[model samples]
Target chain A: MSITAILINAFALVCLIYGFYRDRDKAVKSLKKAAKSLFGILPTILIIIIIIGLMLGFVPPAEISRFVGEQSGILGVLLVGAVGAVLHIPALIAFPLAASMLESGATVMAVAAFITTLTMIGIVTLPMEIKILGKKFALLRNGLSFIIAIIIAILIGVIL
Target chain B: MLLAGMFIVALILVSIYPDRRGAVFNTSMDYLTEMAFILPAVMVLMGLFSVYIPEETVVKHLGKASGSKGFFLAILFGTLPTGPLYVAFPMASTLIKKGARISNIVVFLSAWACIKIPQEMVELQFLGPEFMLARLSLTIIFVGLMGFVIEWMMKRTNGVIDG
Candidate 1:
């Protein structure tokens, strides 16, 4: 396992032990919740893995670069940002997909925009947000998030 | 439904384009392995947070916080690895009902959406510390600003916000 993997696992293990020491019932409850969620998200995980496979397999690096690479410019970054807002993938899975895109020739700006918007703005869940948080708040938050995502992406592009 | 469709599509495509099968399998395996290494641990952490840090606690704390303290509490509460942004909708709504500042609510929602602890760890693993840190720092700065901007807009257009 990589260092990240090891560290994460270690952290979880330590937390688990401490939780158990603090409260056996809650610790067990946490484990159950963990198992339930692991299974809950498993399907989405598999789907993302497959999509990544097909994406990297069929799409040429040149094609990816041509669309979202360094030369694709601002339009490409905006395009990805819009797509990110519309798509509802879990943010955890998005990182790997973003990494793959980065490896395949997508620019840092494009990937950053993709990640930012994908996580921050949720067009798919807009109605629920409106229902719960009020129309103005939801719309304003999502709309502003889209703009903020782009600005963050551009800054990341400039800085890194 | 999407999962099954994707699996069938992957099978068909791999069979038809036999030459690309190796690439597909290799890439998928690489991702699967990486996911396998971290996902369970991530889930465990999420579970613990969900159980230990109940929504009531969050509301109690954030509703009382104000000014810079509220912003700090909002971001801090938002970064906890609990659930998706949608799960936070009701909590934010409750905060608002409790008269939590609009800016703090916005900051809370944005932080919950993106700047999660587990989410950051995944980014660090896949994108490296440099990319992760740069994006993270920039996100914090911009998201903080966005809170104020959205709050200002909402205030100027008051009475438009339903419920």
Candidate 2:
């Protein structure tokens, strides 16, 4: 396993042991919750994996890069950002997908825009947000998030 | 529903293009392996946080603080590996009802949406430390500023936000 995997697993293990020592019932409950949530999200996970597989398989790196690579520029970043806002995939799964895109010749700006907008702006959840937080607050937050996501993407491209 | 559609689509595509099947399978396997190694651990950490850090605790802490301290607490509470952003919506509503500052509520909600601790670890695993750290810091700075801006705009409009 990679060091990242090892470190994350070790951290979870230590937390588990500590929790068990502190309260056996709560620890076991957490384990059950973990398993339940894992299963709950499993189908979406599989779907994402399949999508990634197809994307990497069918699309040549050159073609992939041409749209989202260095030459793609600001337009590419905006396009991916808009897609990210519309799609409702879990953020946990988005990282690996972003990594795959990066590996296949996507620019840092595009990937950053995609991930930032994916997590920060939720066009899918706008109705619910409006229902709970009012339209103005929801609109402002989402609208501002899209703008910042673009800015963040550009800044990441510059700095990294 | 989407899962079923994906599977059917994948099957047909692979069968039609036998030459690309190996590439597709290999890519999927690689990602599946990576996910297998980290997802369970990430889920466990999330479960533990959800179980231990009650929503009540978050509200209690976030509702009381003010000024810079409130902003710090908001980010701290928001970054905990708890439930999804939807879960935070109601909590934020509750905080607002309790008279928490609008800027702090915005900060808390934005942080909950992004910059999550477990989420960051996953990003680091896939995107490397340089990419993840840069995004994280940039996100924090901008989200912080956005919070104040939103609050200011709402204040200027005067009672425009009535959820």
Candidate 3:
């Protein structure tokens, strides 16, 4: 596990321990809730895993860079943003890839759009989001997020 | 049924492009491992929040009267070193159920997704201070506005919107 993952688990453990010490029944209740939720979402989680695997595995690297390359302009930024919205790579991995794109002459706007949309929108997780948070909230948040991600990228381009 | 269909399609794809099987499997395993580590802990945290923190308290903090304080609080809570965006969905649902303002919840979510501290550090390391700072500031402004805009649209649409 990554250090961040370890730390997160440790934090959860600490919280559980503290809760148990204060109120065993409530702590157990939380554990039950946790287990229930984990099981409930397992299928969606599996789907997310498979989808992410396909996206990252199948897309050619050259194609990826080309879609968001410097010469691509606003259309390139839009394409990069769309890919970022669909591709579910962790931000931890996304930064280095984005940086490399920058190094290889991807425009500032395209890179920015890629990172922003990658973090903000999740087409793969849309069903789970809709299931949990309702269709309106999910669709609106993601739809608006996509628009604003591009706007942020453009503004970044203008500024720097 | 969808899952089964997806599985079959994947099977066919792998059979057709045997050369890509390793990449697909390895990537799937990598993500599965990552999710295994994080999801349970995230669920536990959510459960703890649900059980320990009273609904009224949550409502008070981020509910209808959450006000501008809720906005900043959402940003603060969101920027904490939580996991990814998918993990935030359940928590956001719980908050909404507890009567948290939709706008604040949106801000919290966007912040959780984009401005997590470690991600920012990585951005700084890779993309330079200028790019990082500019994007950060711009993201904050635009994400906040997006939240309000979405919230307004939801309210304006009224019961027509199932949000």
Candidate 4:
């Protein structure tokens, strides 16, 4: 596997070992929770993988990028960013989708904007935020997040 | 529902373009394997963090700090791998009720939303070091800035709460 993957596995292993040493019950409980969550998210993961395949295997880069490609510019970035904000995909799954789009011609800016906004702003959970944190705090956090999401995207596009 | 739609699309593509079926299958398998490598590990890490570091611990520790130290505490506590952002909203409310600064709460919630370690590991795996690291560092700076701006805006609109 990639070195990053290796490091992740290694880190997990170390954490697991240490966790068990600290408390065997909690460590096993964690593994159980891990298994449960994995099964729960599995279908979504499969669906996302399939989507990524279709995106990269069939669509040519030029065609894919037309809307989100480098030349698609600020409008493209904003479009994907809005989708990110509205959609409620798990961020783990979102990464592969974002990476697939990047491979298939989406601009760095657009992809960054999508992931950033997707994780940062949650339309589905906005009401909960509003209920708990009040309308003003919820609105400001989400609103400013959108603006910075674009700014971060543009900065990423320029740097990388 | 989306999964069912994806499966139907995949079936149709395989049937209509038999030649491309192998390509699609192979690509999906490739990504599936990659995800298989990290998802469980990430989940395990998350579970461990959640179990080891309970919300009570966060409230107890973060409730004590204010000013610059509180901002760093918020970011640090937020970066500890936990559940989803929705799980954080109530935790944030508790922080506020406990008298944490609005700027710190904003920073805490933003970091909780975007900058956890497992999330970073996934981003690093998929998006490369440069992309992951750049977005991360930029996120830290911008989220911190957003926190202060939001705090300023809130004070302007609602006046200052003495709590």
Task: List the global CA lDDT of all models.
Answer: 0.90, 0.90, 0.79, 0.89
lDDT of 1 by residue, A34-129 (tens): 999999999999999999999999999999999899888999999999999999989998999999999899999999999999998999999999
Error of 3 at B83 (Å): 0.7
Ranking by lDDT: 1, 2, 4, 3
* Tens digits of per-residue lDDT for model 2, B1-163: 9899999999999999999999999999999998889999989998888888888998988898899999999898889846668778888889988888888998898888888888887898889899999998998899889999999998998845688
Candidate 2 lDDT score at position B125? 85
lDDT of 3 by residue, B92-118 (tens): 877877677888889989998998764
On TM-score, who's better, 1 or 3?
Answer: 1
Give the TM-scores of the predictions, in the order they appear: 0.96, 0.97, 0.63, 0.96
Q: Which scores higher on lDDT, 2 or 3? A: 2
For residue A12, what is the lDDT in candidate 3? 81
Quality of model 3 by C-alpha lDDT:
0.79
Return the candidate ranking by DockQ, descending.
2, 1, 4, 3
Model 4's C-alpha root-mean-square deviation from the true structure amounts to: 1.8
- Runs off by more than 4 Å, candidate 2: none
Provide per-model DockQ scores: 0.81, 0.81, 0.44, 0.68
